[model samples]
Target: MAGFLLWLLLLVFCWPLALLALVLYPIVWLLLLPLRLVGITVSAVFAFLGALLMLPARMLRGRPV
Candidate 1:
């Protein structure tokens, strides 16, 4: 696509910047890893609580108490 071609041209012309970003990307990801972990933990806890709240209703349906 045109976007890919443009990106390729940019990479060719700006390789040093690209390389710098490549080296720093992982470090930045590592620095933000704890935030990602906290988000995941919060999402999992909410899902668990929802499932627990739904359990009684599921059992009352008599489908498989």
Candidate 2:
């Protein structure tokens, strides 16, 4: 993948910073996990609201001739 290649390039160019990033990646992901879950929940709620709002219109549209 491109990310791995980029990281490899970084490792080749600067091992210390690359190692820091490698070590910090998991910690950063763990910190951001809750935000990601919230985003997914928000998106699902929005989708449910949209479907609920459109229900009547879909019901009235009925079958095509």
Candidate 3:
């Protein structure tokens, strides 16, 4: 992919920094994992609230004969 190509370019141009990034990537992802989970949870909660708010209107709309 583009990222791998970019990293390969970096490795050719500067191995040390590229290695540092390679090593740090997992640590950075681990640190950000909780934040990603929180974002997903927040989105789900908002969706549930939206559905709850719409329930009454949907109920009253009823089905056509």
Candidate 4:
């Protein structure tokens, strides 16, 4: 029950773009997937690096940590 509610909230908040993804899935898979995959991978790598850089600031604040 609690897990389901948590998962629902997570899905709602994290996947707000899911509907758009669903609509675009076929088109993306058929046409854009290969082209976009490289960009996606690069973007993910940059985002990860950005998050890693921010981790020190977050930890130093001692807020959540």
Clashes per candidate (backbone, < 3 Å): 0, 0, 0, 0
Per-model CA lDDT versus the true structure: 0.87, 0.98, 0.98, 0.79
Ranking by TM-score: 3, 2, 1, 4
Model 2: pairs clashing at backbone N, Cα or C within 3 Å = none
Clashing pairs in 1: none
TM-score of each: 0.73, 0.90, 0.94, 0.44
Tell me the spans in candidate 3 whose CA falls farther than 4 Å from its real position: 63-65
What are the runs in model 4 whose C-alpha is more than 4 Å off? Answer: 1-32, 63-65
* Per-residue lDDT over 1-65 for candidate 1, one digit per residue giving the tens place of the 0 to 100 score: 99667657767999887777768879999999999999999999999999999998988898753
Candidate 4's displacement at residue 50, Å, is 0.3
lDDT of 2 by residue, 1-65 (tens): 99999999999999999999999999999999999999999999999999999998898889564
True-structure lDDT of candidate 3: 0.98
Identify the leading candidate in terms of TM-score: 3
- Residue range 1-65, candidate 3, lDDT tens digits: 99999999999999999999999999999999999999999999999999999998898889564
Better of 1 and 3 by TM-score: 3
Give the better candidate number (2 or 4) by TM-score. 2
